[model samples]
Target chain A: MRQFTATYKLFLQHQITKGRLTLISVMAAIAVLLGFIIGSSGGDTREGAVVLIMGYGINFGVPIIALVLASSSFGQLKEDETLVYLWLKPSSRIATVVAAWFAALSAVIPAVAIPLTITSLVASSFDFSLAGPTFLAISLAVVAYSAVFSFVGLVLKKALIWGFVYIFIWELLIGNLAPGTSKLAIKTYPTSILINMTDEDINGDLTGFFVSTPAAIITLVAITCASIALTAWRLQETEVA
Target chain B: MTQQPPPPSSSQQAEAWPPKDSTIVARSLSKSFRGGLVALSELSVAIGPGVTALLGPNGAGKSTFMRLLCGLTKATTGDIWVAGGNPRKDAAVRGRIGLVPQQDGIFERQQVYDFVYLAAVLHNVDDPQSATLRALELVELNPQELTRPLGSFSKGMRQRAKIAQAIVHDPDVIVLDEPLNGLDPKQRRHMIALFHSLGEQGKTILVSSHILEEVERFGSHIVVLSKGRLAAEGDFRSIRSLMDHQPRKVKIACDKPKNVAARLIESSSIASCTLHDEETFEITTADAGAFRKEIAIACQKSDSLLSEVTPLDEDLESVFRYLVGER
Candidate 1:
């Protein structure tokens, strides 16, 4: 709890003054504003729907935020040579890592989720029934994606590059082209949930792009748990090199 | 040849008084990184109370030894105990020890009070507010700086804040790895005084430093390391006596160097003398104080003024080189 409070204080400071954090928040706001403008244009509903979809896609910013936050989590300690102090402290490593992850996650989730939700509501005419489930799916997606990226952030020195590759190359390219690989992408499960909730027909003929409801929930839970477990294990095993 | 007194017994030596009843013991500790880069090699030492200075040059395993003692990294093959428990297995042991690492281990964006208070809370201190205030006072930080972000602090202020955080929990033993690194002369003096007070308060402190004079000021017990080995251990006087045969170099600047040199050569106390220039001479003496007094008397009798008399071999580097054999 002490570690959590300390890390949260650090996050609050970063959210207020850090340029990159401000940039991410601004980009999220701009993306949401663009979505609302296009959704309210009232010419072609399909185009408006496309804009809303883009807004949802911009939810990728959550993972990016996680990457940025986690990249510095332990890396900053090493760079500043402050790990020695913490390593000598009586606090548990698991507690510290978890606290840092949650702190970073808190900074990011709201930036992406709130903006996206507000835009979707204003643009789509207050369809709470549709928006509610979409929000749920998006939140789950944020948590799952952040967890996985946070683990990657701990493991790799070049976490931002790896995070980009994971989003663009692995999720976009391979998950789209190879039907079998889609299940591995976090977007696959949440998109499935969103599709089920909104009755949206995405990738019409792309069988295996989506899975059953139970499988989606199970996959999300499994991946989240596994990423957290990996992070804890890595914290214990790897020396602060 | 002259015979010297035997070194003091272990019981006659100053005993360290730990703030609490706990002994930090290490036996046959060794550490080697990948590619066979050895950091500590079969080194062993015990620390109980008071300020024990771990003196060593760079890469002499001071940091590595601290890490091993704190259980930050596992010893390749050895055993360590702190507070009657294995540091690796016991979190309670850590609660009794405070570590101030070489680098300022602080989140600079946070305020000073918040940082120190958070550390106290993390260490399970019952009253964080009083603990934080006490710690700030201990470091002599201005109360106004408690509300300011650490990033804006000067180097000495940051170091004091770091020390404040390290001791907020009031641990029995405090390990400071190069606690005086970048401080100015005033700050250094202040910190040295602070260390002495902490020791007087009965907190066992293990401070590491490469600077001999700084360590010499407050180091009640000294453990010297050279190339990852325990080169010397015990009080400074005992260690100095170990190198009794090492000649002391004295420089004399006088008006008549040749006359002084000629006069000094006749005395058995002078081992050798060299003319540095027309007005200066360097002499090797077995007893530095006695030789300096003799030179002063000789100058007075010859009616010559002695401009300067200095001991060149009094510094630690000279003693270290004599003990370790120059690399």
Candidate 2:
């Protein structure tokens, strides 16, 4: 547990640099601004608000921020060879991966959540109901995305490039329209949870493309667990110093 | 030091090689990378608790062997026991091994204290802060330098900081790979003293270098590696004597190179002489000490001033070549 705490502290110290904090603030502000514009332009109309939040905020902004944070969890350290400190420890690989995953998740949550909550309130005509559910959905999304991306970061060489492909190609393009392929995309689960929980009157509805609420929750948990497990296994088998 | 007798009818006795008191034992170790490049091939040796210098050229698999011992990587085919535990199978055993890698992997944005402190905590030390500070002091890094970001540090300070991190946990075995590469003469002397102190404390110190003199300062115990194999392992004197028949070159810069070279060649100790220039010449000598005395007398008789005399082929690579060729 001390090892975990130390690793967590080290990861956070590396994460909360001035430049990254500023980037997070700017990204959140921009997402909120986009939400405000969409809400005011179509005043009290839930369809325009839903379209903007789903299309721009959830689909694009949240994933990008999550990807950056998660991919950098072990990627940057491995690239710089500073991962040796953690790798040569008496602690289990499971602890190391868990620490990195939690660090990335914690860092990504606030960065993506502030904008998401603002978008939710503005889109819901100042109604405070959707904020809680939206934040919950986004939090789950960040957790799953962070773990999977962290795993991808460890396993792949050019993880950032491949993360971009996974987001833009698999989730953005195929998951929306393609029939069989959409099931393979991770965003489908969290998006389903969001669609089911958010105000239902919005006309730009993406509810049909999602799985059931229980299934979404199960899949999200499964994805997080599987990714963390794979990361630990990969760390044990592979050599990096 | 007297060797401890092997435990009779024990499982460890079956695999023990190069002796019973050895802290690290590698038997028939080999490592090959993805492209079928064999970094280490059928290597076998045992290392005891002392300052044992691992001498090798650039591609002689020194780093590969060190990494294997550190358990940073596994051997493709052989077994290694470090501190009575297999590092590959036991993660906790890593706490007993400290490695100063050859690569420059400084956390540039972090302060020196934080960097070393992190290593201490990861190693599960009882009190990381105090251990970190003690390690820093051992390496002779001042308090002011500890607070500064590592990127702002000079090469020597960075190297010292690295040493601090490696020793912070007070491991049983410390493996330093080419640690003296960038240190100045004073820092090198200090580091030699530090290594000797650590050895006095009964820590197994395996320091790798390609320079013979650097290893000579630490102690006589030497391990020569060449082309992914153990060429020889023993005291430096014994290893040097193994290649005693080879002609050793000594270059001399004198006032009258021609006359001094002619007089030096007259002695039986001098095998051959090559005049490099008007004031400089090189001589192949079977006996370096005798040749040195002979050269001084010859220069005095020739009325020539000998400015400098340097042993030209006393490096680790040359010795490795001789040993490998003999094998």
Clashing pairs in 2: none
Tell me candidate 2's fraction of native contacts, as a decimal between 0 and 1: 0.76
lDDT of 2 by residue, B136-187 (tens): 9999899987789998998888889988999999999999988887899999
Best by lDDT: 2
Score chain B of each candidate by TM-score: 0.80, 0.76
What class would a CAPRI assessor give candidate 2's docking? medium
Strongest candidate by DockQ: 2
lDDT of each: 0.72, 0.82
TM-scores for all predictions: 0.83, 0.86
For each candidate, the DockQ is 0.33, 0.55
Model 2 chain B lowest lDDT segment of ten: B1-10
TM-score of chain A of each: 0.85, 0.92
TM-score, candidate 2, first chain: 0.92
lDDT of 2 at B165: 91
lDDT of 2 at B178: 85
**Tens-digit lDDT track for model 1 on A1-241?**
6566765565445434467668677767776676667667766443354336433543365556656665566656656665555555567767766666676667666766676666566666655555665566667777777668767766777777888888888877777776688876777887777666666565578656788767877888888778877887776655542
